[model samples]
Structure formats: C-alpha cells, structure tokens
Target: MLKPHQAKQAHGDSPNPVLSINQMNLVYNSTRGPITAIRDLTFSIRKGEFVSILGPSGCGKSTLLKIVSGLLRPTSGNVVLADVEVKEPRPDIGIVFQQPTLLPWKTVLENVLVPIRAMRMPVHEYKDRAHDLLRLVGLGDFINHYPYELSGGMQQRVGIARGLIHDPAMLLMDEPFAALDAMSREFMMDELQQIWMTTGKSVLFITHSIPEAVYLSDRVLTLSPRPGRVIDDIKIDLPRVRDVETMGQSMFGEYATHLRALFKSNTAPSTRIA
Candidate 1:
C-alpha cells in the first residue's frame, strides 16, 4: 500500500505519464443543492500501464472516467493527457462503456469503424486497422455478422475493437464486462489481459470487482464512497501473462483479500446517485 503522497511521487518519477488527474473535483448543481461527485481526486497512469479504479457504487467511478475522457468538465482541477489539458473530447482518448452499445443495423466491421466515420478521418484509411482490431479481439470471423448474431461477450469484443480502432493514446473502460455471466466474465478477463498485453495501451479501468482489478491492473486505486476520493494505491506485484491458473495462486488470493478488506473497512452509507 502506498500513501497518497508516495503515489504522487512515484507517478512523478515515471519517465512518461500518459494521463494525469490533478486535484480533480466535480459538483453537480441539482435542483435540491450542489452535489459533489468527486473531490480532490489525483492520480496518474504511466504510459503502457494498466490501472483500475475500484470503489463502491455511486462513488463516481464512471464519473471520473468521463472527466478523464473529456466528456464532462470538472468544476475544479485538471485532466492532462500527454501534457495537453482536456477541455473537450479529443481523438487521443477512446472510451468503452459498460454495455457494448453497438448499432444493431451495422455489421461488426462497420460498427468497429464507427469512430473513424464519426471523426471523419477517411473511413477507407481505418478499414484495415478496424479489421486488425477485430482480429485482435477475436471477432475477425464475425466481422460481417451483426450485433444481434453475436453473444454478449462477442458484442463486447466488438465494443473493444471499436474503442481501439482509432488507436488512441489511452483507453478508458467503465466496467466493460460487468454485464457478462460469471463464466463469460472470467473468460473475457483473460481475453482483455491479452489485448492489453498486445496493445500496451495505457488503460484506466473502472470496476467494482476486486479480483478483476487484481487480475488486470498493474496498480489499483481504491476510492471512498460517494464524493469519491483516492484512499489507497495498491501495486500488484504479481507476474504478468496471468491466466485462469494464476487466480489460484496464493498471492492472487492475498491481493484480492487485501482489497476486499480495504473496501470493508472504508464502507460507509452513501447516497445513491440516480
């Protein structure tokens, strides 16, 4: 476990940081009053690092991702990606949501290329990259298939392919596999690990699952309940190329247990955000 100051120092010492959140805060002006979704959040993701944000529901995990992705502006603080302050949505950030959110009418290939089309960056130029990304996500054979024809996992793979097609500097994933059944979720976890290893993209994953965070992240940043703030920065020392077998190891269980305990100790009554 690293203290907040130590974590900041460690991140500062890194040769290259892909993303940095400095004293971030977000407050929503609801009719009732001002609600703080996040408060004084600070962290950084080094280039090629896979980091996960873990917290109880309504702790603003997804909200944090939005701020980082430039979808939402924070009331205070800053989100810097590659030394550029994010004011609006930029091409350098790619986001994967909890659901695949695929266009039913589009073929898998066409859906994967949506980003390219939306960015108006010469659809033809990204066609090859789309195909390669589909292959990378194990959807090469399903390129012509529609979203309806694929399983939940397959649809999510299409979502991953779409996120990567643009070749962004970092990927922001908001519980991308939370909807899958247990067996499918477990399988997709390994699949995601392979994708991250292959692409080496800086990833900021938001999740509620301790094991999932432990399995996929180089470091896990745990947040306190709503009005979210970083409470712990845990470095996972486990060897990479992790698999189903890796989950059975003592260190794996220890990391998961430690995170679970942290959450338990930090548990508090939080207002539900609709």
Candidate 2:
C-alpha cells in the first residue's frame, strides 16, 4: 500500500492537470472475500504529454487505465478528466489494448470507422477522415482488406487507426505493440511517434518493455509491484528522434543501464519512465 500522503503528491502545486487520479483504491470483493487490486494509487497527466506506465505484472496497471476510462469505478477515490469527473465513459478518450479486437467481418476501412459509426456522425464527414487516418498509419492500401489478411502488426495499426478516427483528446494504450516481432514493433513505435508529433494529444501508454517505453515516451513512470504506486517518474533525456541505434549511445545506455539495475535489484520491482 502506498502512503496516504504520497498518494496525492504528484497532484499538488503542478500546472493544471489534464487527467487526475486522487487517492484511488480498487478492491475486488469476490468469493474469496476481498482482495485489494490497488491501494492509494495516484498520479496526474498533463495535456499533450506522452506518458508511459511501466511495472511488473499484478500491479493493477490495466485496472488504473480502466478507472481512468470510466470502465470501472474505484472503491474509493476520484478520476477527473479534463476537469470533468469521469463517472462514465467519455468518447473523448481513445483506448487500444494489446490485442486488436477488430471485427473480423468488417474491412479495414469499416473497422476504422467503427468509432465514427458509434458517434452517429454523418458518414460523409468521417469517410475521408478515416481514409486519412488509415494512410497515416500506413494502412491506406489495405483499407479493403479483412483482419485475417493482415499481419499482427498491421492489425494493430488498424486498431490504432480506429482509435484515432474520433480524434480523441487522449489515447490510452495497453501494450499496443507487445504482440509484434522486434522489427515490426520498432516500426510501430516510429509510426506512433509520427502520429503523436502530428496530433500532440495526451497519451497514457502502458508497457512492460523498458526500451519501448523509453523510446516512445516524453516521460516514463515506473510503478512498484502489487497495489502499485508511483516509485519513480523519469524523463527521457534522449533526443526526440531515436531508434534501435540510440541504445548504443552513452546517454541512452546510461539511462537504460540505470533502469535495468533498478529492475534487477531483485529485492524490489523497480521501474523507469525515461
């Protein structure tokens, strides 16, 4: 459990927050009685910022995202988005999970249009928008293809395109590139950076890979194990333009080695955000 005082430390005296979670505690009351999923967890993310949450398994990372998305209510605490209390799912937030849950029957264009359709907006308005997004994700040529015809990375691109269709204020991704091979993952990271640079929306991305987190984020937030708490929030000092080759540089390797040692301490589940 996190100390009560530390739970809200990140929220105090900062610039106005775009997203705020205050003293959040999540508990599951199951047949086994009650289990604490996360206790006294808290943080705030600013608008147009790319923040990555990194932690070991069972840290309630997904649970925290769910809470922020209004898919789950905290047992105790508050999640405020854009100064509005997030009691229900707001369409302004986009989410992409590890798996691309694209409807098999829908073509790539149609899949990307799902969110737009849900908005009940005029098809003509979003049709070109969808095409532009597909192109942005490098899937313009495959718009008519089905999910089965696409590779894992391609499918994930479709998922990301779909998420962007509505032009959400923030994107919440849960290991969006974890399923891809190394090369594919690298490409996806570049694609994500491209999209982020262009859109400049707030992003809360969750990942288990240090390199991926470091490569894609403006800041990487490391969480401690079960009933997770923010242990450290490190800024990536690496240049905005980076790649696998960046790992060989002193600046990149310094941070990577420091983070590696933190995670390898063995006694503690340490993490890094840079």
lDDT of 2 at 104: 98
Q: Give each model a TM-score.
A: 0.94, 0.90
Off by over 4 Å in 2: 1-13, 266-274
Over the stretch 162-181, how does candidate 1's per-residue lDDT look in tens digits? 99988999999999999999
**Each model's lDDT:** 0.88, 0.82
* Lowest summed lDDT window (length 10), candidate 2: 1-10
- When summed lDDT is taken over every stretch of 10 residues in candidate 1, the lowest stretch is 4-13
Q: Which pairs clash in the backbone of model 2?
A: 220-273
RMSD of each: 2.9, 5.0
Distance (Å) between predicted and true CA of 218, model 1? Answer: 0.3
Enumerate clash totals for all models, in the order shown.
0, 1
Task: Residues 1-274, candidate 2: write the lDDT tens digits.
Answer: 2222322223332378788888989998989788787878778788888889988877788988999888999999998888899998888889999999999999999999888778787777889989998998898899999999999999999999888888887899999998889999988999999988888889999998988887887777777776777767676777777766787777666556655655555225243221
| Model 1 CA RMSD to the hidden true structure, in angstroms | 2.9
